[model samples]
Target: MIRKRTLRHFIVFVSVSGPICIVLFHQTSTRSFLKDSCMCNCAMDSEGRSWFSQRYKPSANVTLNRKNGLLDFHTYWWWKSLQNESVVANYTQVVEVMFSLFPDKDHYTDSSPSRCRTCAVVGNSGNLVGSRYGALIDSQDFVIRMNEGPTKGFERDVGSKTTHRVIYPESAVDMGVTTHLVLLPFKILDLQWLISIFTTKHIDLTYMYVKPSIIADRNMVMILHPAFIKYVYDSWLQGHGEYPSTGFISVIFALHVCDEVSVFGFGPTKDGVWDHYFEDFKSDPNEGPHDGDFEGKVISQLHQKHRIMLYKGW
Candidate 1:
């Protein structure tokens, strides 16, 4: 009976002293751990916790300066000549308006002080076939994929390094989302797509809805607010070189949202190939309405600026 009583007392003592020992081990002579721990001033946050902090409350102070004079020529010209109608009335205009909003900086450096981990915006052409860049591309910090496409034999060409998928309600597909999903749309219909298509299973959805919008469903998906979008847009508009290429949009999405970014399938092919990926391959190319040469020139300039990388060779 006496030994049982002693054992119970010993158990109680150890439980109370275990925490006290830990507190002493981590505590400094001048500062008391008790006071600091209450305010989250304990030892460094674990790796997992640090990652969460970067995702939720990043230290970098991102601000969007979009005053009147700050607007660029295309932007000033477009907005000043604006009718009372919607600013982004068409797809072309939407692209234009989106390009106008860029981030303050482009490159995100890791250990290299000067060169950042540049993103190669590879446009889906048949050029990337047999390039053996699927695993290499996947090694990048972040990869962005867009539109509807298949990735079996053409994995090298399309790159399997898709860290994020930018989707609109209209183009939402059943392709599996392994990492993050970003919805780029303005109207309620797009939001509906975000809900119906991206179905909130285990995926994390972020809505970069621009102004003149609202969150229809409270529990649908986490939104990034128009202010953040405007911030990115303004930054891109003021950015150097060809302001807002398709790759530029991806970079802007990453600069504002992700820590580092790498692009794939975003440049002109060896020749001219624009048929949908699912469609059979072809030789003749479809240069967009804008002259291919002109667009290529702009893309080259963005590459030089390090804002984007053009995947030219195999």
Candidate 2:
């Protein structure tokens, strides 16, 4: 706990551009303050935590600026996503308007700096079965689950508490009133889709039919910056696979926000079968287009380095 310490401010880099600086309400500053802080698209105040990778630092702040300017156009991921004429034509205008509906900063990090936030990133791997991690997962300060992983029937394995759900349009489901619907926007239409959910239900199609609106609090909605997504792909993954999977993205997201992160149900089982804990086990081929083998190894490496705690249910 931070005792009666003098509150001091520091100049920190919150933008990927590296020029923008903001004064945050942190208690202390060090020579390594700027060096240790996450300088990605969003702002972070990791006073009590330490990270070893330069690919990106640990930051709970996900969104870069109030209005993120543009994704790195050089990457194929950026250029390819911009193909939609209507979506891309008014991308800037759309984002500015949509951001108005949500909180500018991720409220998770708004708590007192002395409090150590512990997080649980529960994956959908079949290994979660028989682990009895429900009680443990629910105890976390924040619990971030990904995709279509359901918790109603399997609360004994996967906890029922969900603070954030990382999902794209195709995998979206109506979450609890308090849970944040963290949208992983693959394209501009995804952004439009989210806006339509709040306003007009006109965007019924985004390569497939999507939920017109969900039973979520519009104030709790959050979107990841494309630049941060690209950073995880290019820097962390070293440009592996077509793009980063939602599972990996969620892990990275938790790392930024939580001082301690615990991951569950991530890799294949002992028999090497890949399936969700909720689904019947089958000798399913590794889920496409993600490089599952590589990602699993990366998760293990992060665990080995003590950056995160990986719980692989036997």
Candidate 3:
């Protein structure tokens, strides 16, 4: 009896410790890998220039003038007060470089002309299943969709009228008729992937990475500077949050790209409902890993606070 008890305890200990040990080892390995993998934490500005140090020293808070290649100021004042643990300086720089690479319409206040007045951002969440927002969606002058946005499933809830599909090369859908394909990438790797999806002959179908690109082609690719992403990260996301999901990014893109916009199939309703039109309408009380209920609550709050019209109707 004594031997059996001792053996049972040992078995239980090994079972628990085995997985825990593996997890800790994997995490430590990843940390070490991240430390060594790339010297430049993020892509450089459009100029493809960057300053980075392997040591976790404070980054100098500075502003750069892209056109004339000038620096306004340099200091560590902005980040000195904050806890470095909560700061992902590398991630922040990555976003900043992405913004610098893109054009800023607000910066060109004198030249920034309004191209979109009425716009609609459509998501493929299950909420759009039965609600017939088709005609209402079609009435909008501009419509933007993100990854895997299907028009067939909730054909009634989210209309078939897609003016533009903003996607990485992997997510580009077949836009048969007048719909346009907007490519968003300055990196050669990203462009290589895009070329594979869109045939080389159709390369002209691509758009510019800036406002001048927009003017050059009224149907130019709309690229938001990574700085705007930094703004959203710092302000709306509270700093440590995950990058905005594709759907949320689409909304922000529309906000800057248009004046009047209505959001469709965004968040979950009051009843803890989380179903996408494409998925079965039956609600599984058991929340899954990808549960949207928590996100739904935040989206609801943002809608109320921002006065953005959210379609919660059936």
Candidate 4:
């Protein structure tokens, strides 16, 4: 099992308190776009740099207060984001209060130039019905599962081991003590929710009503840096989707922390349907804020560049 020291988060400024908008994935069926997804176009960016470049900062995480309580002002831009009604006044105070309970430590101390920590980022695409990828997935040094994707009976295809589970207030579940409950705090209220969940259990509303508490290891909880989310949105997807999907963000996250990453349950299914493994949809899957087509292209670029080995489940 991989042990975590400090897990800080995504830079979120406001709360999505109004509504949780569901953007049905708009499929891009153009041949040119499909080819782009297949080809290793490393020059997709204007700078003409490869996604596999060592220049990419793995420590996208911002350490607000260092060992001596010194602040990194340069990373302060992380708090800039799409504002909403529930804007926070003193960001530092709110952050420090949250850190008072959750320790502020860098999780990558286990990282080394000599070490190779492989990770398996499991998605919930329906194509994994019978691929039998369980053994391969569990064999990795880290197994990252996102949202509510289950591994109980489907272990034969999706694997049962989970080192981390990335979720938001609405998507949260009863996680095991061993697995890291990575929180996607898109707003200040989200952070408040994190603190409340473990202590007072006072928070029970966001864009939708949420569980005040969940089963998780307080020590192992991690937060996704909002800057990291912004980074993926701007750099990787080129501002395509309203924001990056948890699955896409998980892949980018793996690239930053893991030495060798093998992605499973990405892209469309064998039937070309964009859906999850646990649910049954009669027609096309409901759309979300993410641009499913653009995300696919970027993933294809990463796959072609040899940066990641994408396992499009059968």
Candidate 5:
């Protein structure tokens, strides 16, 4: 009878203690795993000289060969069937334009200077209206502006110096020969439009009457690789929305090219209104095809991770 009682007691004790032990072990293991993982990731990010950097270098040295197979050609170009058709029909022309316009070398090299190259990604958010970030934005090595985010009247808020301007056909603006026109081509026609503008000045219709020709330097024009766009779309955004926004892609572009990046005039206004500092259009800024909320979250994550400094101007 005592033996039976003891057996019952032991069984109950085992049943009760098993889960507790497992829970304790899981908690300890999770903490240890997180600590080690964080250390590894931080170390990798600190070096900034890994295969990730080499693979995604923001320059024209990225070889476009058959083996690589135009991985991102169809990403944002067209619908599934149309994308395949476009790639088959216009791949060579698109590539030819890219090779002809940009240099054949990568921007940064192993022998490049050790000093940090600061960049300012100036968005057109209404928060920058009276922020007086002009001087601070101009101080960076590279000042990247998007669309028609002008600095003429608002030079006190948005810097006048622009090293790079990211634009597509719809939001195209005339830039100086000194500024690099980083073309974010969403479709094959966008590429054709650029070529025609630079050469024949024929094609001229995008949402609005875009300039058929601009006064930009032929050599300074750099087309963003579709693969790079896809990389940003898939990796950083985890395939969140229809496509990545021009501002978001421009930020990622800066991350590859500059050692330190500072973003200005992003997000909504102080009063939480989504409108440009330059103009108040009768459309919703956050109602675009791109997921603005998801992009904002990613931007916040980048700021939190110390990869980039976000000047909210709030």
Candidate 6:
């Protein structure tokens, strides 16, 4: 496992009131644009780039603080506060585990000035059942898929090329060694599970029997910053849902990473059914913690604003 001394500085503990708060040190330098007053638009201003872009965009250089680490103490304890001993222990364990697995540096960086970068954010909506969008999706410079959106059995509608996969322990799956495993940690336990699976093979429980270990490029493995996730929840969705879904987070992640972003397999199907293209069972939008309807509206708004291109394949 690759280790870096600077990884320890990624997260800093501060005393707030009486309890300890985990402050994401890197995000302190950046301004917060997700405040309620600035919810209207993400347009660029004369001052410089839009706050949304500046806040979420992937850094060109991988400095120690820029690497994936918990930055916000409030966000870290948003789901569960550190008042509980278990929570603090879990947070410490996760930090240690992450440090052990932290890459020497980022693998993907900004493309050269001469090239135009395009990315496809593919979901598993049943709308892609017969769209035959495989070739178009594969042609992009990057193809990002979320959860267990498969291509082996549904290549005609969904492309087979997967450059990056945004997932958590619950929705984890194995991928080619060349693909990047972008872990979207919802909580401290999620981060612990990710490191445990890869290093110790002790975590085998989730929604299903998760693979104790996965085969993927360690250098390319990326973890989404908790602050970034909070930004999407507060800025992009305006706190509409309990939390941003993995698919929604992936779209926002692509916005920062790719110059041109295209979305597919989101929203309801032709018959107004919520289902995955690779599965026959129907998905209930209300079943999960996410507000699917609100997310759909936000996605549509992004498309209208020209921030993203939504491909609602019939």
**Against the hidden true structure, what lDDT does model 1 obtain?**
0.42
Cα displacement (angstroms), candidate 2, residue 16, comes to 51
Taking the candidates one at a time, how many backbone clashes does each contain? 22, 4, 8, 14, 0, 4
Candidate 6 residue 200 C-alpha distance from true site, Å = 1.7
* Winner of 1 and 6 under lDDT: 6
Reference-based TM-score of each model: 0.46, 0.78, 0.51, 0.77, 0.74, 0.74
- Arranged by TM-score with the best first, the candidates are 2, 4, 6, 5, 3, 1
Tens-digit lDDT string for candidate 3 (1-314):
99999999999999999999999887655543432221112222322121112211222111122332221222122322222233223433433443344432232222122122577888766667667898899898888777567887566778888887766544555555466455533232333333333333242232323111111222333443333434433444444333434565566555444545688877653355756566655554224322244345445644554324578755
lDDT of model 6, residue 75: 67
The true-versus-predicted C-alpha distance at residue 287 of model 1, in Å, is 8.7
Worst 10 residues of 1 by lDDT: 33-42
Give the alpha carbon lDDT tens digit for every residue of 1-314 in model 2: 14323222122222432342223223133222442342211233342223344555444236634644455546435635534444354667767778777776644554333445788999998989888999999998899998889999999989899999998888888897899889887787888888888898787777778888877888888888777777778667886777788999998888777667889989887777778899885644346657767777778877766667889886
| Global fold similarity of model 3 (TM-score) | 0.51
Q: Tell me the whole-model lDDT of each prediction, alpha carbons only.
A: 0.42, 0.73, 0.49, 0.71, 0.72, 0.70
Task: State which candidate, 1 or 5, has the greater lDDT.
Answer: 5
lDDT of 6 by residue, 248-305 (tens): 8888777766667889999888889888888787878756668888888878867765
The stretch of ten residues in a row with the least summed lDDT in candidate 5 is 35-44
Model 2, TM vs. native: 0.78
RMSD of each: 14.6, 11.3, 22.7, 17.9, 14.6, 17.3
- Higher-scoring candidate on lDDT, 4 or 5: 5
Off by over 4 Å in 6: 1-70, 79-93, 104-115, 206-209
Score residue 54 of candidate 5 by CA lDDT.
36
lDDT tens digits, residue span 1-314, model 1: 99999999999999999999888766643233222111112232355333323333222223222222143455444433322323223433333333243322222223221223333334555456555667766666666665454566666556665545555444444444353344554342343334333243321332433223222322222222233333334443433332233334455555444323344554434565543444665532223222334445544554454334445545
